[model samples]
Target: MRIAVAAPTGHVGRHLVPMLIRAGVKPLLLLRDPDRLAPDVRPEVDVAEVDLLDADAVVRAVSGVDALYWVDPPPAGHNPLAEYKLATASAARAVTEGGVGRVVFQSSVGAERRHGMGEIDGLAATEVALNATDANVVHLRCGYFFTNLEYQVDAIRAGALQVLLPVNQPMAWVSPRDIAEVAAGRLLSEEWRGRIVQAVHGPADLSWQQVVGIISEAVGKPLEVERIPEEEMRGTLAGFGMSAEQIDSLVGMSTGFLGGFTPEQERSVHSTTPTTLAEWAYTELKPMLQ
Candidate 1:
């Protein structure tokens, strides 16, 4: 089967591409810069250089593909909700025009609700728009990314872990590799039909304190947990040069998480992946720290 993948250079896409190849499926990568693809993988698959925001370009790129793996990358200094809507609309148009048979979208948890969801609203909008297309769609409602902690490596190394949410609130966290595995399996199989919503949660629902404890144990250092207030999140993001819209969106997401807006279902036996916090820390997180 031939599958077209958007954001092929992203965190999940980078892992998914190799898995697709191993499963005896061909991947047509839609890349902004084809050179960003690993040199070894380039000769194995087809490449299409196209801007996702351009409906005509996306339509051309997805033409003749059997399936599509759609992942919207983080927005670049614009209204994230509006940007996602445009991208989803473009992809939906392409799927209809190109006659793509199936689509597996990378969406987040709590996308079932329509409002007060900050960045998640974008995924919710994407889900609604893609559902309107003719092709079969599967929404992988993923949880918080464990890799997001990598951004705080410096602070972590200094024995401090900061978060906007309460330290004791439990939230599901998934590894990108696990997400890739599930997505690859879905892309390779023809079992699922129509609209499917699969909650891709991690092995455990852990609190911020629990996660920090794991990290501290892995790093062999006592770590301090600092919970920043919701109001301070805007100023913190703004200090990083994020625009007003971006700040509002990010803060909104944090607020939603603090309000217990994550996936409510138990982890499915079929969806439980092999990777764990300790494994990820020993492998991915530790290497980055050094």
Candidate 2:
């Protein structure tokens, strides 16, 4: 099977290419600059350069593919929603026109709106776009990334871990690798179609403080998790290059996290390998903390 993957250098892409190769699927990556791919990932995957915004280019590039790993780039400047909408729209059009067979969209877990809670409008919009295509679309609603703790790795090393989360919502954190595994299954299998897959944390849900404690223990330090005012999160994020609108959107998203999510139905979907926060801290995130 021929698979086309966009933004194959991003977090999920790092694991996806290898899985695709091992599954005996020919992987073609759509990247702005092919050099961005890791050396090991690049050699095994075919490269194609096509601006996703350009219809003709997308149609040409999307043709004759069995599946697509759609990871639309966050828009340039400040409009993440606009970028998400436009990019997904283009991909949907191109896929329909090109007669692509399957699509595995990398979407956030709570991409739906809840009253006084978190909203996932962007993911919902992407789902609508992908649904319009003739191809079987599997929306992988990925859980909160464990890598979000990367920012705090430095703080953990410094012996003062300041966790900025506002509430103690139980969230199932999943690694990009696990997300890729689920996505690869959907991409490679024609049996499952037109379904939404919520890929969540391996073991179970963990609260913000629990995660902080786990990290502190992993680093062997008595770190402090200082909670900051919710009003300041947007401005604080701006320093990290997030646009004003993105800051707002993310803040709104966090509200959902504080409200909480359920792993009820998704727990039966399979792909649970059972890795915990402490395990990730001791392994993947340990060195970074040091």
What would you estimate as the lDDT of candidate 1? 0.85
Worst 10 contiguous positions by lDDT, candidate 1 = 257-266
Off by over 4 Å in 1: 262-264
The pairs that clash in candidate 2 are 111-120, 118-256
* Best of the candidates, TM-score: 1
Model 2 poorest ten-residue lDDT run: 111-120
- Residue 79 lDDT (model 1): 82
In terms of lDDT, which candidate is strongest? 1
